[model samples]
Target: MVKLSLCAIVKDEEACIGRCLDSVKEVVDEIVILDTGSRDRTVEIARDYGAQIEHYQWNDDFAAARNAALQYVTGDWVLVLDADEILHPEIVPQLQEAIASDRHLAINLVRQEIGAKQSPYSLVSRLFRPLPGIQFSRPYHALIDDSVTEFMAQQPDRWDIGYLSSVAIVHDGYRPEAIAARDKLSRIRKAMERYLSEHPDDAYTCSKLGALYVQNGEIEAGLKLLRKGLKQEKHLDRLLRYELHYHAGIALSKQQKVGKAKSHYEAAIALNILPALKIGAYNNLGNLYMQTGDLTGAIAAYERVWQIDPNLPIAHFNLGLALKEKGKLNEAIAAYHHAIELDPTYAEAYQNIAVILLKNGKVFESLDHFRKAIALYERRDSPAGSELRSTLKEMGFKI
Candidate 1:
């Protein structure tokens, strides 16, 4: 039997710690909770789950607290998780079998940080590992991949890393409500800015800070940092360099700089990083091409996205728009229907379809779809609903 230690560094996680523990209690042999001065009942909740608790003072450094919990891990392998994350209940036996087989010293499991049940993005990494010499580094957004790689290089016999695609950990820590409640983004930027002040040329640090700035609506400032980071050659983390380029391209696209955005997207795509990110770059590149009146280029880019994941409503809807612009109404309508099938409440798809119907003189069907689109938009209190309502009144429809 393989010993697996579930290690976590938590603060005030009263609302979510129990669910986090309950989800993994059956999977781990030992639970080690290191609290960094929680004013709530976070420690009490962990104690109910039979966790060995330790307390550490808040030092404003995440890596220091993480390393403290690591010292108490007695198992051969450590699975690090956050209080706002939950392991899929069904993946436990699979996890046990994988670790027992000892096929790899490190495992990359899917970490899905869900925005909603409908749209969840995934990140996979070496979250489950044997911490022989690897310790989380940096103060704010800490990382351990470099140290892990260095450790694995010396242990040639166990240099292999396994991937568990089925075992997903759902992280709810970065939800908008959660971030606003704690003013988390401001604090994150503070720590990241401090790190970059000392190591200005560090690609990964600049990339991360750039991304946060873009998220907070600082376009020019974020783009400058990302472009500068891309030119730097000091960091051994080539994979993160690709991520920075992707973000830089996004910032450019957001500012409607099509040519520059296309260049960076092309650069990131060429690196062939993760499949999802690869498709994302292509999708955004396609949108840029479409915006620049390159319908052929847009179609090709959207086709690539559909090839990777055919059910993405945004890709299908975009493909429909591009097809409609190219004078392929039948195919456009088909694509729109496909998009609607994937997501029933796709208001844009309904509105687009209704516009096409009106163009074709299908009055009754068009009115029906217009009503659906209006209902959806009105529920969200957006400008589209008002415009549609005004259009209907102009067309002599009863209010």
Candidate 2:
């Protein structure tokens, strides 16, 4: 059996360290943690799992902390994770097999970002051999890609990079509540801004920092940085390039530059990347098409979204709207039903269905759906609930 080691750098992560360790304790042969000034029981929790802990100074550098953790790893392979992430149980066997392979030096694991509605899945190169030349880079959002690339170039025939399609890690650090608690946005922005000043041409940093600017409502600055990143297009990998274009599309759409936004969306979709990663671009493009009265294009994009991930309620709901606009009442109702099946509390889906039913003379069925929608809306304290009640009452409908 191939021995695997878990490496992590944490500070004040007492709340989630135990959960992270628990998920991988059975699979990993050794646990190594580098603590950078934790005032809580984070080190104590890690010790309970028999982790080899090392104390390091807080330098505000994620890559430095991660590399420090690698020093204590003695296993044949290393699996890097954060305190807020858990190794998915289903990927245990897959992970073991991948690391055991002779041809693979590193594997890109799929990570599901919890609470992220726009882009939930991402690829992270967190599994690799602890080679001398392979270390992490970037001050924030640190990754080993740069070092791995260098190492691969130095020894071209040594090993190749591999990927696992199934989600290997579930990360909750991006959740709204988690972000608020940690104030991650402000910290990340400071780190990236400082790094970008020193390395302005760095496409990866540009892409990330640009997106952060857009999220912070600094659209002009975000577009400027994203465009700067695009100027170095030849140096970017498929993933970085896709992100740049996707983010540019978002920033442009916010400015109401529809033509430019569509172009960027198309560029992102045309990239040689995973279809799952293109869901945001496809969905946004569909919305633009819908706004421009392009029913065919809207329907096609929404259908593509459905094909990529049928479990998404929003995809089904969006398709229903496009179908409704196209005057396909039956098809629209069916799509809305699919949305409701996926999410029972989807008030908009119920209300839309009710409207269609009422238009078709199915008064009783419409009333039932409307009541369900109103109850759900009221639960969320939405004004739509009272508005619908008033409209129904004005129509002489008895409750």
Best by lDDT: 2
- Return the TM-score for each candidate structure: 0.87, 0.92
* Cα misplacement distance, residue 206 of candidate 2 (Å): 0.7
Q: 1-399 in candidate 2: lDDT tens per residue?
A: 788999999999999999999999999999999999999999999999999999999788898889988989999899999999999999998888888899898999999888786677889999999989889998899999999999899889988999888889999999888999989999999999999989988989999999999999999999999999999888789999999999999999999999999999999999998888888899999999998899999999999999998988889999999999999999999999999999899999999999999999999999999999999999989999999999999999876
Which ranges in model 2 have alpha carbons more than 4 Å from their true place? 374-399
Instruction: Tell me how candidate 2 scores on lDDT.
Output: 0.93
Off by over 4 Å in 1: 89-94, 101-103, 116-122, 165-167, 233-235
Error of 2 at 349 (Å): 2.5
Candidate 2 displacement at residue 155 in angstroms: 0.7
